[model samples]
Target: MKSIRKYMNLPGSLFLVTLIFAMSMTPVSASAAALRADIVQCDPNPAEIGQYVNVWIKIENIGNTRAEDVSVELIPSYPFSLDTGDDTVRNIGILSTDRHASLEYNLHVDENARPGTRSIKVRYQDDEGTAWNEETLNIWVGSGSDTFDSKGTIQLEQITIEPEVLMPGDTGTVTFTLKNTATQYSISLGGEEYDTNARIRSATLEGTDDITVKSDPYHDTGILGPGDNVELTYNIEVDDTARDGTKHLEFIVVGSSYTYNYKWDVPVKVDSAGIKVIPTKPLTIDNGVATIQFDIVNTNPNTLTSVSIRPQAEGIEFSPVEYFIGSMEPDELFTAEFDAQVVSDNISNQQELALIAQYRNGINQHETFLNDLSLTIVTEKPNSGTGLASISILLIIFVISSLVMYRHKKHQQ
Candidate 1:
């Protein structure tokens, strides 16, 4: 009976040992929670100075237990400020194991922020105020070296000119359109849309020596809201001495905070108020007859009225002494022809043909005359058929005269 009791006691002892081992293996809930925080994304990466940036922070419960009443806070460093007026601490109700929660915040970078990578600190804790995790988010700020600010707040949209083509000594207007291209959006921290002003405090025009600003060169444009545009007009005068070429003009947009310089070329053309006379065919004299042909070109921008030409030559007679051209527009070409007979015995090989052109300049209908225009006349040999015919007629006239003389002599004898 004693041996049987010992075996039973051994079995009970083994059972207790097994029970204790199973209990030890079971997991027990702990008072503290295991949390991990990471900054996953930053919108408008490489943020611009003096601009707002959105940062997204992610929190995950890596441990087996759940995190209760979690809160997140942002600690800004130098050149980085909290734009969102709300408290830094954000309340997150609960987080389960292997689960994550995201929080967003808006931060502003100072205008004088140095370029390069910077850091901001984020702290998270539980309801009991026990510290959970602290992490750093790296941010990059622009150096503001580009023409446009990093935020793209202000831009030069379009430039227009009155009388697209410019002439010497002409006065015109130049219009510049400045637009506020900044985008407005609601901030999670502030619970309102961001507000910023795009102000073009002043503007000036710069050009070469040929171009001058007639009126006030400077202008003041008040503050502009998002998507708002303002037009700045300037009166400019082109010098009379300006050549017929392209000239560069600079439009400078100046603000109390920034400056932008833009350049454009203006084309200048010659005035069209003159005429050009050119010879189309050479003047020739054959068999005591002169043929003259020439062209008259209207070079003026305006139309010429009552155009007439008078041809005069010493020791010469012309079939049509004058020619009347009704009207001639700009760049129009009119041809004039004349036939003249030589009347003088002594004639030089080259003869001068005098021509006087009269026309209305279109300003007041006043007749303007271009006089004493001379042309050289060259002597040319007659064609074979005409030369032979003239020689036969001369011979016939001489023979008839000789026969008449012979008959008269015989009668006298």
Candidate 2:
């Protein structure tokens, strides 16, 4: 009876040992079936604001056993959003040992994303629904300047201004070039080959009070494909009262997928008109009458209209002192002449005369007065009168001598 009991107990103990060994091996087998995943690359390396990007991930079965029912997921956070709707999770199915699988996902970067490096969590699992590995990927986000679309598309290429130097009360045009720098390709979806189109919804211009936009701000450019470009134009006018300096103009470009805002400094220069009075000939006084000759010059870019000059001197009388110049174009010169008499004999040889210039800038038709113009008056040489008298007396004496000589010759005959 004891031997039989021992044999039964030994068999039962062996059976219990076998059961424990099998249970211990179960975890090892499960552990052998593991998955590891890493980010391969992300399209649009520097993600743009309010735009979609594609992220590619490479997964491999690094363990001895095969992984079944494999799945990958992205842990969402701020500045980064999932565009896959409820499908943030992807099923990779079966992955054999040392084999790899590539997965792609569509994600969106938020419009208010700060510019810098950001991280996102990626996770993977196997058939047993057990977590395998979690990875944190670093991505770069930009402020529209360095960002591009998934297909390497650039929306705003360049902006150009006509009449590079802008002046007050001047009208000009501005042009913006929209380009797509993407490589061309076609993908079949729903049994149809679909091509990508870059669509511009609107374009607008904002300027300061000194500048006015005459053209409509909004423009619709239908579509642009790979290596294609379009030019948009706007008309602008500068205010007459605008001062000369630097002004800014803001351009906003909106697309079906994104929006870009840019600012440019435009130089504003006001056309200036000036007046200068210069003597055309020597100013001289003869027999109490002073003859004045001068040239009035418009020394600036703007045209001057209704130009007139008035001359005044102390202790001197002027005949028709005010001269009408009519209209003067830019850099124009007008000749003027007048006569004046010294009211006092004590007037010096060099007299100081004040001349006032009155004209309109032609822009606003408002009169502008310049009162600082001056002229110099010089007296003629007193020796001129004495010399003329001497010559007259010599001529009369010669004529009398000739008449007497002729009469004496006739009497002798």
Candidate 3:
């Protein structure tokens, strides 16, 4: 009887222990997995100062089971300020998933905000109130470092132009003004260098493009404390092959910061340089010969164009009525001068002369000039040694006559 009672009691105790173990195995708490935050993008990708940015984040539970009542909080630091964009950056309040969904956040940075990499710590708690996981990220803002201290210190000049008109293959030049507001600045132009002594740095044509300009080997490398400026020159070239219409330098810049984008408007004009005459003024016509002045004013923004002048005179001799005026800017006056002596064999009542200039821009370097310049040199009666020579001979004869008469009178007296 004692042995049987022992066996039954042992079995009952085993059952109770098994039941207790199973109850204890039931899940009673939620486990917090690692927090993974991925940056989708900061649209306008590299954000500009005072510009709006859209950032997307991808969060994952990274746990075996789905998460419940998920929440994330973002805190901003210096230079990284957030504009109150309703619910864009605030807590999602609650979310649930084995993988966190991509949530978009809209933020705007102030114009005065500093530029740099910014990161936000992600904090969250599960429905069961477990431990929080966090991480950091390197956010990119601008393509280059934002030297706010250097901002407005270096600036380009304003470009202005008048009479927006031009002919095809025309060449001209535009001027721009820039200044350095900061105390010191170093400028690099076409591999050349320059420095400013004071804080205010100013440069003209600082950001013009496609000018093919080489800076003087001596650069502006002086320290600028404030309010200093330098003039920049761009040698413009209008391609003969350029379209007959308008030409543009789409992206000129003053500084890297967004606030000072005024440099984009630096003055630029294509095909606006006025007509260029091959041979410019001061043409002299010999007896019975006629000639005209030929010239060209740069009608577009191009470098000093080399020109050839061809003078033509029919029915009369033209003493090579041609010359070159290296280059001329828009609104500038130019004239070529040469003596137009007539050839011995020439005969015609009225004669016409032409002067032409030719050069290359891109392809098809063309020629243009003043044509059919009219000079009516009515044939003078056959000269009996006229002009200075005739006058000299007459004077000599008169002197001889006077001396002879005076001598005779003296002899008579």
Candidate 4:
């Protein structure tokens, strides 16, 4: 009895042990908050002394959980001070995981500040009453004694649009060649010598409702010396329902800062024309089969490649499943022929056939649909000439037999 009681308690002990083990293995959520601060923008970068400068700092939370009671503080040191009547600390209620917040601060540069790079302190707190995390960010201060200045001008030297012309629902690339048109490395402006190197801070292609830009904006394009050029390409797509004619996109190139920016209207031509399939002969199926012919015309202003046509209709069979036309030039025409037959008797007297035209504009594949076409199915009719000929033959044979009987009777008499 003692051994049996011990065995019975062993099962309960194992179950209790398992319960404790499971409780220990269960995961617990941790309270972790990772935050980072960076200075995103400085108005009039290379800010001049004796003036107020606007600074923008971005704080991001890159942790698994939300950062509660987020706040940021700006600490200005020598050569920089907070603008009069401005607070140093900003309150940002909460920042979720992978989310960010932007803070703007106004600072006054001391009149005696020298032309050089200076560091400023920024502190952020994720939780209330928690230790503040600090970061040092640098800003450039410019003065008359600056060694280099962006004295050159940037121009759009060339614009290349792939396929030359775009059709509705097509995607292509627009490449821009930006050039610093200055002649010498240094130039004199108002008795001041400045370097002619042009720095492309950012380049972006703006799109409208009809066109969509698929490429990201280009930033920090480096320095382009006098007469140097760089090519930047952007992928764009045209809306399927876009109207015909020329569409303009605004291409902006910023040099050095916001004050030195170039904006140009880049025009792209959109032609809504495509392959047109028209029946050249009567669309009639006589005696269960017929030959159908269609004229494939390239109505587009540009050449199209890999041209092919396929006809489809319910309860109707088409031979040579698809007709292939290698390439077509502008306004070119080609005739395609197909043998069609009625495979189902339930089809109506006339059946609608879809002529799907597939082609490629440059490297982009396109499809044109022609659904208004129809095929007339004509049933076979019996011939009346066969019975008329049989009656004629019978009459001739009767006349011959009568003549033979008359001759035999005459001989017997």
Clashes found in each candidate (C-alpha, N, C closer than 3 A): 3, 0, 68, 0
Error (Å) of candidate 3 at residue 97 is 54
Question: Lowest summed-lDDT stretch of 10 residues in model 3?
Answer: 209-218
What digit string (tens of lDDT, one per residue) describes model 1 on residues 1-413? 99999998998999999999877764344334677776544544556688887777777776777888888888989778886575788889788665667888788889888888899998887555564568887776656552233222567787776634455666767787878776662122345444455655346665455666655545446767777788878887666677766667666554434333333343433352455666677666676876777798877665667887777778787768888886888789999888878888877766666677766642223333454445454566657998899999999999999999999999999
Which candidate's TM-score is highest?
Answer: 4
Candidate 4: regions farther than 4 A off: 1-147, 167-169, 183-196, 239-241, 256-260
What residue runs in model 2 are displaced by over 4 Å at the alpha carbon? Answer: 1-152, 185-196, 259-413
TM per candidate comes to 0.33, 0.37, 0.32, 0.63
Give RMSD to native, each candidate.
30.5, 29.6, 28.7, 8.4
lDDT of each: 0.67, 0.70, 0.51, 0.86
RMSD of 3: 28.7
lDDT of 4 by residue, 1-413 (tens): 99999998998999999998877664222237788887656665667788878887878876777888998989999799986678888899888775677788888889999888898999988878877889999987878553236878898999999988999889999999999999998978799988888888768787766787789878788999999999999999998888999999888776764467677999999998889988999999987899999999999998999999999999989988999998999999999999998889799888999999999997889987889988888897899999999999999999999999999999999
The candidate with the higher lDDT, 1 or 3, is 1
* Ranking 1 against 4 by TM-score, winner: 4
Give the top-scoring candidate (lDDT).
Answer: 4
lDDT of 2 by residue, 98-179 (tens): 6677788777898888888788888888784575578888776767555323332446677676545455666777788878
Ranking by TM-score: 4, 2, 1, 3
